[model samples]
Target: MWGLVAAGLFALTGYLAGSAVGHLGLMGHPLALRTTHCWTTGPSTTSRGGSTGGDWDCTGLAASGGRTHRITATGFTSYPVSMPVRVAQEPWGSWVPVDQGGWNKAGRALSPLVPLALAVTFARWTLISYRGWRNSRRLPTGSSE
Candidate 1:
């Protein structure tokens, strides 16, 4: 019973954490999300921790507050060229432009599974315990006494 409750807590925490990380532009490089400001091109974007998750080479221009910022991100094959991207600027000045397909939003996509898996595990535990108790309560099929 306590295990189930603990799992529920863990699930909620994980989901919330994932959401926060994702929203904070720390999805690609959560472990090494560098905030140190540096120059990549004409003092436009942050230089460090640009692609800590992988060798992401996607580059594009983001319009934030009417100012265009050059950005390199670890998401999407081809960024949307028509609509204005909901860009997330990291503290280091990295720009993460949101795409339509959601390939980059891994945390938002995967976080809820933590709670789901926990719930399933607890459900299995309960089922097994109930079965064990039921079987224990059963007497011998053909008792002579």
Candidate 2:
């Protein structure tokens, strides 16, 4: 029941995402994630947690159109000297930019299928679990077979 509801919500999200762009869920206006290829300006910072490393950040500077912009990557550490940085007026800009976010034609076409797949999987598991529970209830108490 809950799974079906979730499927409906997710399906709606995919549809909205594919049709138009907005600030809401999966509706971010696509932006061409292209700008100056920024190069690292200083040393990166990092922190490690118990098992998984906490986080890393690298600062960079990009020069384009006689203007230099500073950019930072939170989860990126020392490695590539240059990285593509996008400057946008809106915070959600490039949030799901089709060109950069891999929202290809096929992806848009098949987005609705994901919810169906999830619903089927959830229903199957629930049915199997319910049958097992029913069979267990039918067994006499203290029976180990």
Top model number, lDDT: 1
> Which segments of candidate 2 are over 4 A away from where they belong?
1-105
* Candidate no. 1 TM-score: 0.32
Q: Write the per-residue lDDT of candidate 1 for residues 27-63, one digit (tens) a residue.
A: 5532222222222322223476354222233455544
What TM-score does each of the candidates earn? 0.32, 0.32
Q: 27, model 2: CA deviation in Å? A: 21
Counting clashing residue pairs in each candidate, in order, gives 0, 1
Over 1-145, each residue of candidate 2 has an lDDT whose tens digit, in order, gives 6556656756665654544332222343222223333243455354643343333344446454666655543322233333353322223332221222445545655666666677667767767777888999999989995
Q: Score each candidate by Cα lDDT.
A: 0.50, 0.46
Task: List residue ranges in candidate 1 displaced over 4 A.
Answer: 6-104, 140-145
